[model samples]
Target: MKVLFLQPPMGGWVTWGKHIAINVNHAQLAANLREWYPNIDVHVLDCRALEIDENTMIKILKDIDPNLVYMGDALQTTGVAAIHPRYKRAADLIKSNLPNTKICVGGFFYGANAQNILEETESFDFIIAGETEATMPELAKELSKGDPNISVVKGLTYRDNGSVKMTDYRPLIKNLDELPLPAYDLFPMDKYVGFNYVKKYVETYHSRGCPNGCLFCVGWSNYDKRGKNDWTKYRIRSGKRVVDELEILVKKYGAKFVCIMDEDFNVYRPRVEEFIDEMNKRNLNVPFFFMGRAPYHLRDKDLLKPLREIGFVCGLIGLEAVDEETLKKLHKNVQVDQVAEVVNLFRENNIMSVTTWMVGYPDDDESKIKNRFERIDAIDPDMMALQIMTPLPGIPMYDELKPFIQEWNLEKWDFQHAVINTKHLSREDLGRLAAWANREFYSKPGRIQRILYDKNYHPLCKLIARCYVETADKHAQAAMKNEVFV
Candidate 1:
């Protein structure tokens, strides 16, 4: 039996610094299959990394003709949301061309809404509800026997007797160290693109789950039927384990820069300290970046200089909103003061900070929106990502705003477009304001000049700052023109 993990062509997004990156989750699943089910032939077909087109992708899929085709994304909500549309397109092509081949879909996108998605389209044969590492190998093993009982496979969803069916939820891995590292060798490591210099710039998942129950976020299995443990607790890999992977990425793969793609990289300050210690012992001097809550910076304020000394160049702050009332309603659990402090602290230490916010809440008005702009400006983060508040399926925000949701098209739920209008503002008004807010920040000559000439910034960091500024300019223009906000 042969299994292929396909990252379809015409797929992927430039959401991160406007650069398309390799999905490490793909390598993780492929590695687990190779390690646990060595009898089966495993292959990866990443049209995204190879820059293949639809015609060529069709040709290659037919050539490989794997018995099982898998479609999944990075094990995060935002990552899957950004790429789910492409996966649907790819699965349609696969189903049409290779009608006999079995198709399986995983990741937060398909798994959370497995029943609806399965009912809507016949493209995906099975969906994994939670994690795929343990489930995928077992699934492949069953299929190889030629008489498979998919119902018995935990965390799996499939069609049954003309109705959609889902099995029991899969339990979260208690210890992350038990899993194999991502199979980077199986991917086109050289072709992976990043916002930084064209060296091997890759990202990794050192941990899973976040306990912070922000209503607007899909973090911590909030939208899936994941086990109870996942809903309340967070799990992490050991400092030693994290360093081991980083060492491999930097030395073995020649990675000059890396991004820690964890939702809460600073969930535990001690883990970061241990990571720094191991990084030094291994002499792994690769510069890296991470994004997380603002309070974590206060916890590690003393370690800022040491982190910088050992190649920590930047950290993205999840500043969802600067208004207290809005923050309370969203359960962001972050204070505006903390955001201002974190931005200033990172600036003093020469580490760049990028803060993100969501506009177009149901009660928002022009005055409130303008107030947010002033608040963000006061904090003065190196960059800002002011996106419209897009309500997605299976989340509290989505359910709450269902009546007000004007755009039912799933593809536009990528967080870049204005889908819902506020009580006092129209969707058109939100788009225009979003455009103005984006231009208002990036158009600042002082900001761009300060970053371009900052002596402490890494050359690649400077380049990334410029990239986002330009991307924001283009996106803003698209919004004003009533085109796709991406």
Candidate 2:
């Protein structure tokens, strides 16, 4: 049997040159499938990497002549950011061209609602829910056996006649070390390019599941399934296991830096300390980056200092909104004051910091939007990314505001689009506000001066800043016409 995994091209609104939009470790999924059926030939088709057109993709599919096709349903290119419309369009095209091949869909979309997704698309023969490390192989074995009934397969959703059936949910993997290393060797690792902040870096995950129950987060929904308060529901690999992978990447693959792509790298304080201690003891001096919550580092200033001393260069922290009410609505536990204090701490320790904020929340009015921008200006970090609030599928905000959604087009769900109706502003009004905010923030003389004087300034930062300025100007021009509004 032959199998092919496809990652479709991104839509025009979300395209970013030649880089893949989401940077998931799909090698892990492919590697797990290979382990289950070693005799079966496996291949990956990164549509973004090849920049394939419809005709090219159809020809490739015909040439591979796969018996089974597995495509990621996750849309985001580098992170679990948002759904890309191209994936949906590609799935439709694949179903039409490869009617004989059994198609399977997995990733964030199916993980959230496998049965609904399978029914809605009517494209996938099976949907793998949750972690695919164990379920994927089991599914392959059953398919190879010519099993007609798929409902019996645990952790999968499949069509049964006209109805959709779902098996029992699978438990999260506890012993991550037992799994094989991702088959990075199988894909074009050399072709992968990191963004400016991670130019010399490769990405890896140390754990699964987040303890934080931020209401606007889909991750929080997954963690809440355990039904525990403050459900620190994370499962991590041992420091030895982590270091072992690092060693392979450094020595064998020529990886000079790593990006710990966890939701919060320092969630488990004691474990992180142990991991950092081990890294220092072994003299593994590779520079790295990670994301963290402001409150976590503020409570342990000493802990952050050590991480900085041991080669941690920067951290990306999500400061969703500056106002207390907006923060509460988004279920971000940290206060605006805490964000300011943490920014100062990181600055004092010589660690670069990048903060993120969201505009266009459902409850936001013009006054609220201005207030949020004011907060951002006051607590300005080394760098910042401002985006419109998008209620992604499966998030609490999505369900709660479904009736109020002004736009149902999947492509508009990108953070750049204003999809939901605001209490105080029209979609066009929000677009104008976003353009004005970007222009005011980046074009400010004080902000420009700070960027020039910053010791850690890099070429990538300049590129990103330039992109922001260009995007802002483009939006400003469109806003004047009032015809480009979503």
lDDT of each: 0.76, 0.65
- The sequence of per-residue lDDT tens digits that candidate 2 reaches over residues 10-118 is 5322212223322344677677778767877888887665577787987898899887777663223332333424555766788798888888766654566566667
lDDT of 1 by residue, 1-486 (tens): 989998886433334444556677778888889988899999898886787888898899899998899987654423436566777788889888988778888766665666677787778888777777788788888889867888888878888888889888877777889989988889888776666344577888887777676777655322355565353467788888999898888777888788888878887888989988998888888889887788888877998888887888888888777778888988788899998999999898898888888787888889889888988987888888776776656566766777778776655566666778889988778878888888888877689877778998877678778777667765565456544421
Q: Which candidate is the best by lDDT?
A: 1
**Which pairs in model 1 have colliding backbones?**
none
TM-score of model number 1: 0.95
TM-score of each: 0.95, 0.87
Q: Please give me the total number of clashing residue pairs in predicted model 1.
A: 0
Clash tally, candidates in order: 0, 7
RMSD (CA, Å), each prediction: 2.0, 3.7
Candidate 1 CA-lDDT value? 0.76
Residue 105: error of model 1 in Å?
Answer: 1.2
